[model samples]
Target: SGGLHGVGASVVNALSEFFLARSWRDGYEWTQEFSRGKPKSGLKKGKPTRTHGTMITFRPDPDVFSKTHFSYKTILAVSESKAFLNKGLKITVENKRDGEKPVTFRYNNGIQDYISRIVQGTTLVNQEPFYFEKEDDFKIECVVHWTIATDTEMHSYANSINTSDGGTHELAMKAGLTKAVRTYAERRNLIPKNIKSISPEDVYEGLYGIISVLVKNPQFQGQTKEKLNNPEINSPIDTAVKNACEAYLLANPTMADAVVKRVLLAAEARLASRAAKETVTRKLSSLKMNLPGKLADCSSNKVEDSELFIVEGDSAGGSAKMARDRKTQAVLALRGKILNVEQVASLEKIQTNNEIKNLLATLGCGVDQHFDLSKLRYGRVILMTDADVDGAHISVLLLTFIYRYMPGLISHGHIFLAMPPLYKIAAGKETFYAMDEMEKEKILAKLNGRKFDVGRFKGLGEMSPDILKETTMSPKTRTLMKVQVVDHKATGKVFERLMGKDPKARFVFIKERAEFAELDI
Candidate 1:
């Protein structure tokens, strides 16, 4: 179903070797079959049904793809998103391959429901979202709400197609919201006269918004059609969103004031952080640039071709460096666990920590407002820790650091957690490795009748250089669990509940996820 323009049906038909389609309409039912996009049979009559609809079944050609596996999650995401964008449309997605659990999605409330679903965990300034629509040369509609969450999330669509690289419409929406909120704050005398004017980043810090537009003859910037190039619709969209948001705020003073306070607080924090960064910058012993002395830097300079392994301890670091591909793989050894970034109060304090400083500098991206993903030195930033509870804690601490300050690294699929073998089994000259208890059991069963010895790896340092290279350091053979953001808001909430200062929240979170936990001696 992923195709360009109206080619969805034809594209699916062309790629599928065996295709079947049925249509029930006009007091008659018709069916057809195709083999490789060619008609195997013409219109065949079928028994009449109560409803009129079309159903299609397809199996993509095996030759077209090296692997034929499909992602149920991807299918479900498309169905759910479509159901939300098209009000009153019912979409039922089923995974027939895996016990076929069907989920029905019908969003009569449209983007309002989507907004509510996205902000379920966050504290909202307004319980009910503000929705607006306008029709003229272009049909524009949007829904917006502010959350207690720090990051601003914006989703944009043109003709129901997601525009990940937002263009003029998104810019217009931001400008409108910022201007309206700033004006309201000023009129209410919420800001002290000494404070500088509010910034767009401040007003948008906690914004959760979606902008959907129906356009005619859309001009796109690239092959992906990620951004809209048409400039004519910007003014109209800006006017519509601004007027609607302004009107809603005037009608609800409490909500408006609360929103203003949230933005003002964000602005204050930004200023404080910037001032602290300046101080920290001055405090550095030297401005001379160099990789951390402990880091075994890779020869490759291209970001896409390089990987950095943040190993747990000096022993593991030495092993990883010896096993690593010197051409592209770099290793940095941390003494112990990184500082809990959530508990750290100031940017200067974070900068002062040697290990944290090395990480920031090695990435070639500063934390907070100074972070530039384009200047990042590594394509993959992997956490190569031991397979233990402490290792897990270290990973969480590192994740917290990235999520809090340089979130772009995670969202862009650059962060990963390395998977090292947990056990090594040798049967005479034949040696086998296992990643988990299940894998170990399988390997033991495979060498059932033969004499074998089992060796459990307590840490990466325990593995010989050759074994480490084969199991964890080699890009071709290593198993790396990518750290990605599937649901930004949900992920943020989980991070807050697990790593923030709220012990009660953390306990509740642990309890919820521990339902399937089993105690091990």
Candidate 2:
């Protein structure tokens, strides 16, 4: 399969302000230069050389691009993917801007090496990855490995180009693998009698696979080459992969049994998760008029006009309730530190926690996979905590829970953090609110030695109802930071290191960034 219809190089040259092309062939070096698609210099012979290769370098035209900078990580990932797709191919990437060391990516065993790298520390159901390659009218190569993880990770390629949206090839792969696993399990009587059947999702729960196909002419959905559109290749690829997987499973009974057992476990979890979700849904449905007992609900029934503030304690909750607009704003005061959802083993376990259940009920949006954005009760969910280290910790914990379960809250611009003042300064009867020490100092500096009184707030509970309404609760004067997820992969790693069960991970993380940390103590 080919991409860009042979216009890739020409397009790059056209978009580049400065372009240089060098070629070594016929025992001589030839060079050419171009600027904005127009030739600056004709092809010229430099010197006789033994090497025979082409090299092109170009700088993106600043006028054509708003931002001309390239991300090193993205480039490295694309380079590594190319190396993995073509076995024994070596790709080197160098970043001169940061003086970072150049890195080389080479995978001798191709996708098998990819699976090995991905599952390096992960527990595996299959010790060895199953690999098959067919070089014919359409070259097809695939590798699959099963792990103890709960999700599937698969990469599909069409002619070495990444196909992120998938299409016929990916569909074929899933069907083939599911068929192979189901047949093997049935033949060996590995599946339990009580369990009805194993689904495709069950078979792929812990599976990691890579599928690469090279067709003479491939049909892509768009210019991005995100999906394959060919219908004829599906049946042949499915049959080939199914036969290959069947033979491998028959040859290795131990691995086959392990795979089947993992699938069965996933199937069981699916049933249990479904039941748990149903129970939660039924219970929540019965509580239309019975919102959380502690919640002080707003008078308005219109979702868009309403807001909910999740306060830290009863003291703060009381202050917020007294300060809020009765028609638009509601308050829910959590008694203590809510459950640390990162440590919870399952969704069912999370549902069992009283505080979490109350919080979920208050939101009116179901948790986890059952979450519905349309069912959300409030237009905005504001976390109004104290301006201190403990408050920050509580906010992080709450964010972890929301990110894991109701990600739509953050992604859809519904989640926000209330920026309450830490210090209130009165200079000659003119009052000023400061969010932190820096703001307080700036305020003092501007006072210019005038007689003033500075009051430091211990927490939101310490602030008066009138002051809270004026500075923190009123939409006209208050500052709220919208929660957003910029890089979800990095965010997940941070959450795992800080809130995950392993204390050592937190220690290591703190140690690594200790120099940059500003300890309040």
Candidate 3:
């Protein structure tokens, strides 16, 4: 695994305190043992077995690495990538730590199967992924598809080495595909002469593509081989891909039409977004820009020190404003439930929404390719809602927006949720704010028969400004759950099912998980 990981066979051996290698070939067995990279025993005879494969086992030296444990998921993922790159290759992964059954991945169709596997749960424009491979001069292989979801993913490789920060090879692939699609669409009279030609950005919207390039003398950007910079390799690969795509579309009219339609939609959105961005920029320049009137201003000019809270209502916003440090904390209250962006079709419509527009203006980070975290006004953006059914719904809606559009916010660890108390218990001039029933019960037990005044807050509006400051707004006392996306596909699937347009899927999801849901009232 080159760019895939930092580990290697010799490196592993050198860092291992104990190592063993066993090989069974041609009905004979051979074994060697090592300790701390030094061979303890020469090749020796071992028990014969039917299998003719080699096995290496090693225990890492504690002196070498801070952590000695292995990750099953990481191993499996690398193995899967290998199997995908090499057609007709079979790889089996096993993790004995958790007593789980072993799993094998064998792909006869190579990257096409890889694409199919990746897009299994997501809605596909076509059941089969678009694929092309050429072995002469320079080997170039590619598999691509469009998903119903918004995110676009690209993975490139050079001689089986995963180029995470792809270079010229990936660029060629993108250019080739864009040209091929535009050529086909123009020939098919799909686009009007008045409209602008489809650019790579437009074509890549909702696209999922995987590529691997093999060259005799591959030039890499660095010692780690994070990217391929071979100049000679681009044209040949591009021509091959372009030819393959042209032939594919000519052969499959239905799929070609579907692909063209998706590309056209992407083009429309891109144009619409450009216009909206221009308008927003002009407004901001004029200093008469539209932001949420309810948003309380922060005195701080430093980006790192500022924080923004998207509260549920005006009542909470007012309290939060009074409770906030003023120099750092800003608050913006929602007018009502926001449009579930997952269900929205047009990017223009979403931009036109007052709530979303205000957020974009205030945050200074645009969506999609236009987004820049450096321009973000606040270091932290927290969602503050009540601890009830409506609050939960609002939270999910806001989370969906952030997850789909400003995914980088979560990735950079800037998104958070403020945990305000649900109950206030007062007894003999002493008061405690409880987040849930468990805390309330504990407080009650402590008070015993002291006769305390117990009040359950229906929403954040019920809390006084001082109480709000003490329990939720103050950085010293507040409990903020920092949101993170550990798994993209799993998280995307959840948001899709919950916020997507498909009611049947939502019904099934609710039906399956209904028992675990707690009712507040």
Candidate 4:
């Protein structure tokens, strides 16, 4: 509603190569046809019909657009959202291009149905969503529920259009919810004595909420409609949300207590995280002369030239250090898998692990909130493990730690996985390496029946310094997969399911995907 104004149909019609419209109204069917924005046929009356809607069919001009394909899933999602926003409204979508089945979206409970779907499988602080709708200057419908998660999820819409870049309405909603929760907690003296105060960040940590407002004339920031810019709608929305939340909390004492406890726990975790960050900063500031003893430091002080190779075992570390260019390449050998930060309860607990401590000290960049990319000692942080299942597991463990603690490394493209060769082939004087079984077979096929010696490396420990350098450590010859986070939410969910404390989640995941798993045996 806020996105395209009233000219969306006209614009689409103008941009289409072929456009056909059929309308059933006033006991008659009317039809019109247009080609390339010009009328091909005048509006013609057809057989009498009792229907009361318009049907438009159009083919996008391939000459005007780079691509003219439509995604059925994307259209269905928008239809579902619209149905959820407007209660009892039914929207149907069908894709004839790909022969997709028709889908009908209708929700009776409006945004409450949306909240139910979001919190379906998660641990909940609120048994049911706290829902309320009010009308003043602008109609506001808000629903909220609290989960046991450490992260917050909130969706705000203006005039049925998603406001992803939240504007005045979102800000007001947050303020109102924060005020309500804080007031309730303070009234009941639910806050712990150890906790000084709670911030909005704490109260909304695990909150899942949907705020939908119907504005007569919504002022959007841009053509995208990602944000609502109307400042006048703030006060009404704020008051409505505050009053609704306050009333709900007052009526549901048990839910209120649960919410308060959840908020306090979040506050405590926030405080501990701040303290851990401070501790790391203090240590990093003081420990310039005391890099980890296991780290084979490079001669180059230039961050752009320096590399840190996190090798799997001491043997591999030794070989990497021996083969490395001492001016730019440094190696730090981890004994085995490091602590899984996803399973850990707190950042303080992560700091206590010996392997993690050594890593934090070696990197120079502070952990968590105190992380500074400018202070990093290395341009590249490579994970060089064996080319096997065990090595992949170890790499995953290390990645989990890095993802939870120093995500900046992955985000900034400083993290990489070194591709070590698993098989070594010698055809007379020429030597070649293969990373996997498929690669080895391909290489053998290319050899054309020539007699050759094939050796399978059990681990990186088995590789000589020269071989290891040639395959993995050398920048010019080696293949490195740069670790990146394309989708933060999806990646985080994967880590949670795999490395989290919930064994049941991991079990279910493994069971579902066991058929596709490749056995190292």
Candidate 5:
């Protein structure tokens, strides 16, 4: 039996070479087969089976896919997400090829359990999660919690499908939370004497929440169920969550106290960060603080025409600075590894780090809420690090910083990772730069089985200034991957899992998807 009721299985079947669906209905079992969305055989009556369920098996068409093999881990992740949303549903996925045991996932606590799992590494302001379920001709349930971690994660769903793009329900929840928090803060004197009122942004600093709504007719914004579009459900959800949260806070004084304290701390930090940003602005306005002494900035004032390359070490930086075009490319050479801002609290503290300070100055945009996209000095912020494990780690750390503090940069498609060719295949006068195995094979094929001398480039430092420019730095030849946030909450969860101080959560995450990992020697 298989839990294959949604869009995925049908889509999978449509694109597959062979698909078989076995179903047990009433007192009998039946089987059917299809090939490329066409029915190969009609439903055949089978002997009565004791089991009451369905089983679907599909092999993807090789011609239709880059690779026909399916990722077992990807399927498991999808199943796990489904299991989290559905409270009582038991989902099991198995990789039958390797004799691997099936993975069982069943969450009785639903989204509440999911919240706990998500914030495993975080320091909670309120240990007891706020959960409420209400039904009045409609169904809506919400689970929310406040954490000391200075990141917000809010996920919404309609009929168990993730609404990553958000819709009416999400907007309503945000509005309700904003209103409720503001009202509660004002009433309880949670706001500091000097500060006026807490903004919605300030209040959501350390919040983690989940909202799930079940509707008879779900109006999805896209085919992918990226967003919910039912505007009618907004008022009902707002009322339910608002009333429930207000009552819960009033009843639980101790928990309310904790929440208020955390929010107040966030407010204070917000104020401090703003003040720091103002100071930076004042300094920049008053003093002529030139770009990093090591950097060779481009002449282009138009952000659209400019690209910034964040290179590792002064050696690579120097070469890049010399090699890059003066009119469009700016080189910022990092002396050492940057501060892993995931664990840091004060933005001021983060600003104190030499590398980060230089970066902040070079970028011309402040961090956190104070970050002004208009102030960005370059349109393309490319991370051009050594092609090694250390480079990858550095890139991840930089990404974490940007994601946590400068998310708008990513959202606006300003951030990019420069892909440098790994190997240079040369035969006689012919030379080929191969980025990966596939590219290498293509190049080899083009050579008509000619024996080629392969040269593996270890790092950026090894490459000459011309080679570096030709392979990575040159806009015409460079391969840059733009950073995109598909799901902000999912992205936040990944950062929380990988960079946070939770060994158990990291272990579980890695163990569950270990097979999918492409390890370097």
Candidate 6:
């Protein structure tokens, strides 16, 4: 139960036909070769090098594995996670056979760098990051920050391996944060004198932080290193963070004041939002309005059999409403773009928006932490937008909303993106749909130079209802890709780069990936 590097390399070596591990330690380099968990050669001298680290190369034995190759994304994700957790440690990846240039990643700011990357563009309570490190019998370092994004992003590690299923360290950190914030608020009279309580969940909204612990004996709960079972690590971290945060607050009175004010404002908004939701719930309970005016709901009472198509624009919505299976598919037409929930607090304001209000009323499920999955009317939430850049942006905005407010949607596998064809190729009525440029080329190659007519789908509005149903709306024929947050940190980095206010990051991202873009002309 070592760290990720040790565990991953061990597993790879155990399953490999031939494994070569080179280590540089104590001012010398050494190598070890293994086969099927048995060493082929003892420790041998390697070439002298200035660097001090280990390099493991292993080829999985075909006989041992159903698939011998490792996923590039998976490996890259692991490396990225390491870089994130370790901060200043330099990590690089290269494919030797392909002669690909090595990609180097290093972050001096640690989790603050992560927070800045994740909550880009969104307004923030404070520009400067809060950082603390404490070492005792149990060593721990924590970084905490908040962004304008109305979601919490946290990652915890024990001895450098990610604990996806957090352990005592995470629990302690949460407890510490809750206590520190509550005590500060009460001392400052931020909360009402009558109310004596505040929950951890309440304090964490719009917060992003990372906690890393190093212990000599780490008790992992599973083979995946998802949880830590070390009981001793909790109190040390709790005390350390409590002391550190208190000192930080006192030292940086201005920053602390701003944070407390923000939290107090959020608390007030939360109360108002709760009241609004109760009103909505009471109205629904009375059966005063069974459905929203804009929604063309499905007939099915069973949630599993029902699907909701969130269409952008009135024209696409009309087409979807007509093309939809009236018994199983519901359509909610969005009049215009909704507020970017990423940068907003109190989703109750979102509920005031006509489109969002209609959606909430139709679905009968609340938003944010108040959202009840059981109350949802649809099993599938499909984002059906035009096949253009604007449509893509709208879809992303919607995704950001869902990802922030109703993470359970993605976690439970209910979220999807509808893939409508970009080009409709027809050769004398022999029609074929090309989803992208690669598909268009493949279809052309299949035709063997035969003259064919091609029609580019400008948007969902341009397609007839029947064509929309066949190519994009119908469950039996449509291509729906389920949205997943496999690597939360990596996804956070991507969002920060693309949506963050930093002009330099967005420019670099666009320029680097420009070659992959396909021109519509």
Top-TM-score candidate index: 1
- Score candidate 1 by TM-score against the native: 0.75
Highest-lDDT candidate:
2
Model 4: per-residue lDDT, tens digit, 1-521? 44375578888889999999999999999999988788999999999988899889999986675334565656777788899999999998888777878889899988988888767778999897788888877788888889998766778899899886678888898888888999999999888888988799997899888888888888888776778888898887778889889999999999899998999999999888887667756766687668778999999999999999998778888888888999999999887889888978898888888888888889988787677899899999998889999999999999998988788798667999999999999999999899887778878988999999999999988889899888888888888888866435557899999999999999998999999787778
Q: Give the lowest summed-lDDT range of ten residues in model 5.
A: 1-10
lDDT of 6 at 144: 80
TM-score of each: 0.75, 0.62, 0.59, 0.58, 0.68, 0.60
Candidate 1 per-residue C-alpha lDDT over 299-418 given as tens digits, one digit per residue, 9 for 90 to 100: 997889999999888899989999999999999999898988887779768878888988887888767877778878899999999876677889999999998899989866799999
Q: Name the 10 consecutive residues with the lowest summed lDDT in model 2.
A: 62-71
Q: Cα lDDT for residue 482, model 1?
A: 89
Q: Would you list the C-alpha lDDT of every candidate in the order shown? A: 0.83, 0.88, 0.84, 0.86, 0.81, 0.78
Q: In candidate 4, which residue ranges exceed 4 Å CA deviation? A: 1-11, 23-32, 38-50, 64-68, 278-521
lDDT tens digits, residues 15-64, model 3? 89999998999787899999887999999987766778888999989666
Evaluated against the true structure, the overall lDDT of model 3 is 0.84
For model 2, residues 433-518, the per-residue Cα lDDT tens digits are: 99877778877988899999998899999999999999999999888888875445567889999999999999999999999676
Which residue ranges in model 2 land beyond 4 Å of their true spot? 1-16, 23-53, 60-69, 279-367, 371-492, 498-504, 510-521
RMSD of 2: 8.9
Model 1 spans > 4 angstroms off: 1-81, 93-103, 120-128, 135-139, 147-150, 158-168, 179-198, 214-236, 246-277, 281-290, 342-352, 425-432, 440-455, 496-511, 518-521
RMSD in angstroms, candidate 6? Answer: 8.1
- Using TM-score as the measure, name the better of candidate 2 and candidate 3: 2
| Model 3 TM-score, all chains together | 0.59
Residue 324 CA error for candidate 2 (Å)? 24
Residue 140 Cα positional deviation in candidate 6, in Å, after optimal superposition: 4.5
lDDT of 5: 0.81
